[model samples]
Target chain A: MRHHNIRKHLSAYAHQECSKDEHNIIENHIKTCIKCALTVNEYQQVANFSKQIPERSIPSEFIDQLKRDTLKNIEISKQKHYPPFRRLAFAGIFLLLIGTVTLHIVNPKTPVEYISSSDTLKLDEMEHLASILCNKENLIAIIDQPIPIHSLIVTLKQMKKLNQRHGQVNNMFERIMHQINGNVLQEFPTPLSSCKIGGKFDESGLTQMITCLRSYQRYNDTITFRYIASYYQKIRS
Target chain B: MELHQVIQKYQRPMVAIACRMLGNLEEAKDAVQEAFIRFWKSDTQIKGDPFSLLCRILINHCIDKLRKQTFRRFFSITEIKDLDIMKSNENPHKSLENKQLVDHVEKLTTRLKPVQKAVFILRDMQGYSIQEISDLTGFPENNIRVNLHLARKNMRKWLQPILKED
Candidate 1:
């Protein structure tokens, strides 16, 4: 190998990746040539120092914020028309919400029934509702009487499952409660309790409460956490 | 648990390469952030060697940013600052007197073509083999050899006096 050839292959020679023929030629040329030997040493030092340089670390705050920003962008993208992949994600979310809510209403673990005057029902029905609604694992909150606490729990559970269902329940509560309170002002809906339905539980008013609760539930409120998703992959022993 | 820990552990060499190549702490920081953001967002598989993949991304991003006129003007302005660069504890200079060596390396880096700068950073500074350099840059082995050879020759000519004295 000539000086130029040896110099060109010096990196390969250092890495020991040169073919036997090329390696031997370079080795022979370097032995007989002082300049080639010096050049090889220079390449060695450069390669060595290159290894010593450390990789960079970006700030944790920047990364965390970037992920949040990306997620926000993804959410915004869903609202508008997006590319196919993102459109798919938006469709998936919509489908998931519809599926969960429909399942909750259609195939509930406990059948829903209304309380009425005239019939003296068995305590077994109330006990079943209590067991289904008031159980610590199931209840998000309790509400005023006349509408059994179990009914409220069942509705709340449905609301927790889907934003649309939550809105529906909120409207139902406000309309029915306002009518009852309007008929009997002497009853509850006190100043302190009035905020629960904003002093006039109209259909719209109940819808607003459900909306507020939905917002909280959507973001994850501990007050209504019946089934917390576990994110831990494994717990170290 | 935190992003910084991952960067600190896997990205130190990449940061060092960018800092050495760009010779600006702030720009190096930005380059690293952009690279990790790309990594975090990308569905690309981070197989085998995370460090190698990260270094490639960091260098490539920095190279692109450095190509911008605004960043070039910024570099020209910062070049006049003559600040003493701080070294990470792990990167303490073997010879404090070799400040001249650092200067020589920095000057030679500016003369390298963008791809050559990346190739040199990966092979010489980041301790990657030619094959690994090829993997990161998507260059053929022959092309890598040519660029690396030219890069080494340029550095040798520039640093000849400094190395000889040391």
Candidate 2:
């Protein structure tokens, strides 16, 4: 090694990490080089002195106590972080409460007369269906009652017309009505999908209804009346 | 047995190592305590020596703390004054002069860079081999030796005045 490298490795030389050849070179270089010799000697002296400096004395009793305290603290910290279980339980309780409320609203005591293939849904039936939805707090037309094609047809027309007039005011209910209408069409196919109210009973029809409703919320009443009047007229024809 | 039991076993050595690095018993204890808490909370699969893993974690924790302190010290001149260069307790086993010497030595160590200080504590004080330090620090063997050499040189300069008086 060069003198510079020899100086750097002197601590190692003092600690005896050198091979014979490397040791001989550093040893010879240090002997002639006074600066290297003094520096190496100083490094050796410090290394020896450091060995004598008392190891950081940690009292065993203190450390044992520390371990116990840390163990206790760790448990506390874990509890602090582990709040999800409680939150999940709260969520479960909330869902159960909603399910109960939903069961009460969608009860079977008020039996709905489903329209069969030979029968036509009368104007009273349409009025009853509209009143059931329009009177409720959350006015979406999913009543959980057994529904025939004619009543559903009337329900779709009323919802579409209501969406046109008042949907902007009650945006959430309008969206729900839209989703339920789509689901009924996709999941339950019917031959008489369109109603006498001149509504297409599809997503586009709902959008037009919402646009018309957006013009004036009161326009919904006129749309609803015409919707029922046209359905009866078409069925009579 | 468990992580807590493992802490109970090796905590003294870990504390000693931290005390040397941080130069304060309370901070050292905090550092060691945090290391165990973190290890217990960790998802790491310990496939090797648990003792060695814990030691590495403790050292890294101390080094990180020191690095932050160093950064803060750079912006504020008074910050360095807060370093509590520790002193030995009044033990019947240790003489006053011995405590003075150890205390003086610790005071000298406060001037060292964090890496050099860690290397010195591990190699000289803890009697760890050069290879072990390299493995623990993930520094090259040569790098550990270089820091060890610098640490010794720095301590010697501090000791020179005392040594001459003696």
Candidate 3:
């Protein structure tokens, strides 16, 4: 073999990775070639130095720690695979329960006092009645109560006639009439106008007024009537 | 074989290879542990020798760590010290000499490219055959031989002055 070819195989030859024939050829060649022999010696020393670096023993504590950590990791992965629907179901039920509790706290079911128009209307109770008209819970509570339909209609008519006399109460009457269904005023005879002329309604006329007022027994009509009645009573006092 | 059994059997050799590749015992242990974790998490069926598969995982992990080390070194001045493999109480003079030689070898190995460093350490220091290195690294036998040759040449050139002084 040529010198370059022999030198190229020196690493594999030193490592005993070359074929037997190639090893023998290099072995014989190096015997006479001092440069090749010195190169082989350097290769041997390199290999020896590499092997002398020493193998460390694995620490027992490290193995035990690894085992503990691996087991812990596997357990965590198992928890991650837990059924998603079960978590969703839990969240849904929790939200439903919170909604129910909030509803109860916000709008409690309380006894609603029945205030007829014939009841002694005090000025102090006007504020309380106004609050009842404004509060949703109170409005919903009074929804089932008997509404003084005829009395409310008469009071609204008297207030409307007074509104024409006093320009200041015109806005308040207009607002109250708007809330009480202004069309109802066109349907009913202006009873207060007849009262100003000293003329009384016939029995049939009273029946017509009662029938017209009964149609106004809806919740919104009741709230509007309560508000107007209280304000009219306040103005009269 | 069971994973625990594999650990018991191959962890020593794995740590040995990793220590030489990384030059740090703590990092070697960490790399070996990470390899076991990866092997455990992998869904692929073990179709070949378990030891070879484990060594491949470990070597790849060590190479990634070496890259990260280089990246960190770009922004910092800290150096990784070579692990002292010999106990000082055995023979202080011989232990010191061996330590110096091991340090020199580690420093020279670090200068090599990752693939060349792996091939050289497995072939020379760990005493694996070229075919075994090929099988473990998934490289062809010829590729492994070329890398091994280049690595040895570099080591020889760097160690010439040191060896001559000794």
Best by TM-score: 2
What TM-score would each prediction reach against the true structure?
A: 0.45, 0.55, 0.53
- Of the two candidates 2 and 3, the one with more favorable DockQ, higher being better, is 2
Best model per DockQ: 2
Ranking by TM-score: 2, 3, 1
Q: What is the Cα-based lDDT of residue B50 in candidate 2? A: 76
Which digits, one per residue and each the tens of the lDDT, describe model 3 over residues B28-99? Answer: 878887888777777568875788888889999887888777554532222122222222134433445767
True lDDT of residue B67, candidate 2: 81
By DockQ thresholds, what CAPRI class is model 1?
Answer: incorrect
Query: Which CAPRI level is candidate 3?
Result: acceptable
DockQ each candidate and list the results.
Answer: 0.16, 0.44, 0.39
lDDT of 2 by residue, B1-166 (tens): 6776788778887888888888789998899889888888775887866777778788989888888784444523332232222122233223336556655566667667888889988998788999998777777998888898888777766555444333
Instruction: Choose 1 or 2, whichever is better by TM-score.
Output: 2
Query: lDDT tens string, model 2, A1-237?
Result: 677667667777877877798889988897789987776666666666677877666777888789888988898878876567888998999999999898888873332432222244344554454444443332223333433333334445554455466553225334344444443433443333344233333445334443333333333322332232223333323
Q: Write the number of the candidate with greater DockQ, choosing between 1 and 2.
A: 2
Q: Global lDDT of each model? A: 0.54, 0.63, 0.65
TM-score of chain A taken by itself, candidate 3: 0.33
Q: How many angstroms is residue A226 displaced in model 1 relative to the true structure, after the best TM-score fit?
A: 78
Rank list by DockQ: 2, 3, 1
Q: After superposition, how far is residue A59 of candidate 3 from its true place, in Å?
A: 2.4
* lDDT of each residue in A54-161, candidate 3, tens digit only: 676668887667666655665576577547798899899999999999999997543234342433433334335444454455544443444455555554454334
Clashing pairs in 2: A163-A210, A164-A209, A164-A210, A164-A213, A165-A213
